[model samples]
Target: MTEAIASEAASNPGMQMKYKIVFLGDQSVGKTSIILRFTSDSFDVKYQATIGIDFLTKTVYVDDKMVRLQLWDTAGQERFRSLIPSYINDSQVGVVCYDITSRQSFENVKSWVEQARQ
Candidate 1:
């Protein structure tokens, strides 16, 4: 993720900077999996639905600056969709995840992207 966001964090090494990266997608689409893989270098095979939103932080060097990534693992259930916009309001990046095997999940990517756009 460091290399991935390095260009976006092009700033001087004066002080640590923070960024909010919100993950948005339908249920069981591996939104959390991406975050876990980036922050811990590990993956979980079991499907554990995220309740509400899980906040995780990781710091790395980006363009000689200490960049703090505030990874937001958002709940993908329809019941929690209402809460997404509040968090998305200030996000630096919104990653829309989808399962390649699920057609509906892929279809919903537009709606998620639309939501992030707003």
Candidate 2:
């Protein structure tokens, strides 16, 4: 169903968006957790990793105009970087996350930022 909808969206030139966003980071760096917080104001302590990518949508008021967010959450691992290009291609804003207390996670933010920029 997702693939079909994505295909339909790809073929439709009239489907323009007022806003879109993307989140990128390394594995175990809490990208999904952060997104869950933003979308629902809640977090899960369980550690099941995001397999590839996930998406969420929310509507918000922007200066009295209604706008919707097409939030893309990309998988955070070396092997998953290849899947990120398409996800971030049309995003208007990018968010890069890293665990606050983890040194390696913090360092890896640079690589994630670079990859997201590409």
Candidate 3:
């Protein structure tokens, strides 16, 4: 269940670590944008709703240890709510994002967090 990437380097060879991070929020809350920005350092102005779920992996060095981060982006549509439980079951971290300009989206954070907790 753990998605890990091993690193072979002179300093720290054959070290493997993985972390699953799930993003949860309402539609158009910029979850995708946040992941894209961190993983690729780029953002697209065009808005595309995530269908069901999307995943991306990025490897980074944390305190001289190589760690692979698996980012899970979940759809915010009401219909896709059922699919979230499976994703949350194995996730090590859950991030709930909301648009700062939208009060409704901000208010939904509590529900999203509760869902992730379950």
For candidate 1, which ten residues in a row score worst on lDDT?
A: 7-16
Compared to the true structure, candidate 3 yields what TM-score?
A: 0.87
Is 1 or 2 the stronger prediction by lDDT?
A: 1
By TM-score, the best candidate is 1
Off by over 4 Å in 3: 1-14
TM-score of 2: 0.79
Candidate 3 residue-wise lDDT at 1:
30
Number of clashing residue pairs in every model? 0, 1, 0
Candidate 2, poorest ten consecutive residues by summed lDDT: 1-10
**For each candidate, what is the lDDT?**
0.89, 0.75, 0.89
RMSD of each: 2.3, 7.9, 4.9
Show pairs that collide, candidate 3.
none
Backbone clash pairs for candidate 2 read 27-76
lDDT of 2 by residue, 1-118 (tens): 3343445446654554355688887788888887788888889999878888898887654333445677788888778778888888887788888888789888988887887677
**What ranges in model 1 sit over 4 Å off?**
1-12
